[model samples]
Target: MTSENTIKNQLPDAISARVRSAKLSEGVATLVMDATGLARPQAEALEADLRGALEGAEGVSEVRVAMMADKVKRPIIAVGSGKGGVGKSTLTANLAVSLARAGYKVGVVDADIYGPSQPTLLDPSGQKPKARDKQLIAVDSEFGVKLLSTGHMIEPGKAIAWRGPMTGGALTQMMEADWGDTELLLIDLPPGTGDIQLTMIQKFKPDGAVVVSTPQDLSLIDAARAMDLFRQAHVPIIGLVENMAGYMCPHCGEISDPFGTGGAQAAAGQLEETFLGRIPLAMEIRVSSDTGQPLAAGDTPQGQAFAGIARKVSDWLKAKGSHG
Candidate 1:
């Protein structure tokens, strides 16, 4: 074969060998990995190999992994869960708020279309987003974070009936909304490892992702799946967070692991990503979230938790620089 043909033939092998499979769709070549049993070191090793291979391929305009679910303008860090109800939304809200308060222009796209929690977690009394020249304008929370959510578009009851195409379309619109000079966009993805999740990552092409889970075996298992999703999407897995890891009692001022702690941290180690931090199960976090006010907006335990996470995230981003 000619040298050009030889290069082309070698490209597919380099990519497919690193992943479970590789395919070209819509002029974009993508690599998908099962990544079921691989530990973090193995995954990273595989990713490095794949990156090197793709970097040498000719005629490859874009190479995407099958795991990123959203297409975003800025560097986006996704906060995802394997399943729902592990405080992913709460953590996302507070983290975004904390980042915004720490002098970064932050925007949050609540990609949880089926359960748009940011509307409730951000500010219940907050005004809906406005459209300028047919483009949606993200609303600003009291803490100065720009926000967009499916919650602002459809009623909660009707959102359940939205089909996959509708969800994808809405997510595209929300993600593409006018964030207005934001430095970072934190996406609060819907729970699951399904098509919706995959599509969101591919479209948004987030810079990295953070998985959130409670410290239970079941939640950790799901978090592993979530991490795998990002891995497959070829998006970098930034870290994992153990939410509701422990609880601080208000009456006696003591700590207890209602959910049995450390599972998430262990999982992150196994996966070879950084273990971001833990958020204790505090009544204050729940109350503050429910009231459309996150704990990170003020001087509270929850605020400190989010602030620390934000700092870590900002530091990491500073180190990585810009993607596009």
Candidate 2:
């Protein structure tokens, strides 16, 4: 007979009933439970508790858990930028929304340690994520996108002064969070080719990475560095997206090259990869993202740009069979 304390320690926190445990020939342990009619948030909570149960189990190299589901399916993508200020966070938030709009389970990991903007880009002014078993519960942003950001973990007006180990530790927590039924995990990496980026790549083993850049030559050059970094990490480069590529004058019905157009596209060509598309220098995209209602949620020029990029992203993932 199992003592109450032993049972409580072994069982997941939110397990409504007995959990079936099995050990596979490959040494991977499987934990099964029932979660019918449970909401997404509750499922995430259950996942965290179940994962904790197998953390210290003997000879367990990996643990797989299922809750009222026959199989698991989710594709994780990493989005990187050469440097900051190219609207990478905005693009990440919007792109995640667009992918969800296409009926895929989506989540965004704001791994941008230096400047995490997901909290501002996706959630409102006063919202914050609460902790369950010291694990963060990813806030539900609109468009069915769940968001977790480093910015949300800090106090207001405080800077995160972290060394390589600290930053990597924080990132690990965010990546290992209970992302229940997430079909696509989009990681918004910090700009620049730094230790944090490399560490994240090694830890997560993302399926592919999307590089974001502006039309300017310097940004494009930085974007190339990002592409090379991912290649070195053995992660495939999905495609390149040109943000703020140009401006369309609504009043004059003329288009102008604000950041000088086609630089990202040309760079993608040089790298022998697909150039997803370009987003114009539009006010709607800026205002909407800033207001926590990303432009991709509606039919705007920027929204269309994000949709096009999402389609290209979907097609590329499908071609590589990464979506499975």
Candidate 3:
């Protein structure tokens, strides 16, 4: 007879740690294992491994394993800007790629209904997401980030002339998609405080917001309004990112402030928010984005800039998790 104690002791440390309970009776082994934080494939592999480990045990003819995992609430981060042409979408794409590079399962929701550009930035292959059981699946990008965008749903270059309620409905559909095991979602909100923004705030409240702007007075003013929207809705401001802060001449290697410098940092200080970092107005960034290869996927200085910002955001997330 195989005793329960003997069976428990025989489990590998990795397996035993997850085993909440184990029993052997009548030539059968039963196990209750916690699969917390594991994705479906991982949990399935664990089950197979557990069965394999027990199959050869004395007096064990059958193995039954029950896997239980706590439901994980995925955090949503809104990447917003007060006005268009500030590189908010580009920043969102890079941030998602950088976070994915840092071992996070991240997803991007291109909530810019009128101007869905993530498909072009992240999934240049133009692969449309499939639907399963009426739930839209996220399309996988080469950079390890999953994506759901209005660009995928509609034909290429088609203009979206949707009313507030209609656009809001579309936002809801993307937000409630079947994102498997995605721990974080970066929503690239449309520019300005419009219907989509309000729908995002009221329907699926984000855990935090990252406001993007150029380091110019005009852009900073709009960025402030965007920040105020999130503040009014009680969404925490993760920080501010100064995009297009400076331009570097590729040939001459001279640096110049095309949009002026440090305006966003000053604005962040005035608003009592963290200044995440700046992304230079680099042609490399623009080219990489246009080609659907995020610069953050590389290790160049420009890539490192996005990576640095991602590190700060990751640190903030860790701190938030620790507090909870």
Model 1 residue 233 distance off true place after TM-score fit, in angstroms = 1.5
Alpha carbon lDDT at 229, candidate 1: 82
What are the per-residue Cα lDDT tens digits for candidate 3 across 1-324?
A: 346676778778898889888788888888889998786578899898888889987778989889998777788999999999999999999999999999899999999999999999999999989887788888889999999998998899889888888888888888888777788999999999988999999989999999999999999999999999999999999999999988888789899998999999999999999999999999999999999999999999999999999999999899889212
Indicate the TM-score of model 3. Answer: 0.84
Question: lDDT (0-100) at residue 104 of candidate 3?
Answer: 90
Error of 2 at 87 (Å): 1.2
Candidate 1 stretches greater than 4 Å from native = 1-73, 156-159
- How do the candidates rank by lDDT, highest first? 3, 2, 1
Candidate 1 local distance difference test against the native: 0.78
Q: Is candidate 1 or candidate 3 better by lDDT?
A: 3
RMSD of 1: 14.7
Candidate models: Cα lDDT each: 0.78, 0.81, 0.91
User: Residue 165 of candidate 3: its Cα lDDT?
Assistant: 88
Model 1 TM-score, 2 decimals: 0.75
Q: Using lDDT as the measure, which candidate wins? A: 3
Give me the candidate number with maximum TM-score. Answer: 3
TM-score of each: 0.75, 0.79, 0.84
- Writing each residue's lDDT as its tens digit, candidate 2 over 11-88 gives 545562646444443556676666653556676677787677766755556767786743444577888899889989
What are the per-residue Cα lDDT tens digits for candidate 1 across 35-87?
44343345566666665766546656566664321233478888899999998
